[model samples]
Target: MHLHCYSWTGAGDDLRREGERRPPLPPGDLAAFRASPLPPMRTCDWLLKPATRIDTSPPTVTEAQTWLADRYGTAEPSFLHPADEARIGLDLRLKIAEESLAGGTDVLWGIWLKAGGFICLVVVCCSPNRHADYPCPCRLTSP
Candidate 1:
C-alpha cells in the first residue's frame, strides 16, 4: 500500500513568485518518483533539489493538515476523521483494527513547511510491525 501527501508555506499568492525562482523538475523523473515505493526520507534529494529548495526541515502532521485544508478545502469529508468512521468500509476498518492488534508496518511520505517559508519533502520509508503474525508478507522465510 502507498500514500502521498503535499504541503507548502507562505501565502498562496507567493507560490507563483517563489516557483519562478526555482529550477523546474526534470520531465523524466516525475514518473520514477511516483513509481518508487516510498523511498526513505533521507533519500528525498530528488524532490528537495527542485520543488522544495527553500525548506530542508522534516514534515509534520500539523503542516500536513494545513496543506490539505488549504488545497482541498475543509468541506470535503475525510475517512481518517472520527466523525466519518461510518464511511470507512467495514472490511477495511476491521483489517486496520486487526492489524493494530497483531502489529503491522506504516509508511508515510510528504512535504512540509519550514520557519522561513520554505518547504521540505519527507518520506518515512517504513515503520516496522512490533508483533507480526506468522507468514508475514514483509519478510521471507526459507522453506
Candidate 2:
C-alpha cells in the first residue's frame, strides 16, 4: 500500500518531495495548506528526506495507522464533525465506527494553523474503501 500527504507551500520544494507519494491536495485545501508554515527545515529535514532506496513492500494500513495513533492521538474533530455521523444520508456509519476503533486514521489530516501548513496522511491500513474524500464520498453533511 501507498500513502500520500500534503504540506503547506512554505515548505522547501525538496522537503515536500521527500516522501514517496505526496499527492497534491484539492484546490481549497491546497490554498490553505500551502499558506501554512512549517517547522525549521533543518529540524525535520531528516524525516522529510526521501529514502535511499524505495521499498515496494511497506507495512500494512492497520500497522501504519496503529503507529500513527500511538504517535499522534486520534485527530478526529479536525476531519470529521460529530454531526456528520447521524446526519449523513449514506450508510458509512458502520465503517466509521470500525475504522475508528483504534482511531480516525483512515481519513485524517494534520493542519498547522499558526504557521499555516498541512499534511494529509492516507490510511491504506484497512480494507480498501473507495471513499477517498474524507468524511465519506459526498459533500460534508449539508449542515
Q: Give the distance in Å from residue 32's predicted Cα in candidate 2 to where it truly belongs.
A: 21
Kindly provide the TM-score of model 2 when superposed on the true structure, using C-alpha atoms.
Answer: 0.27
21-56 per-residue lDDT for model 1 (tens digits): 332354333333333332323332223222322222
Identify the leading candidate in terms of lDDT: 2
How would you encode candidate 2's per-residue C-alpha lDDT over 18-119 as one tens digit per residue? Answer: 322332333233322222233212211212222221112134444444444432333333323335433642235334523653442334433332233333
User: Largest TM-score belongs to which candidate?
Assistant: 2
Candidates' RMSD to native: 14.1, 14.2
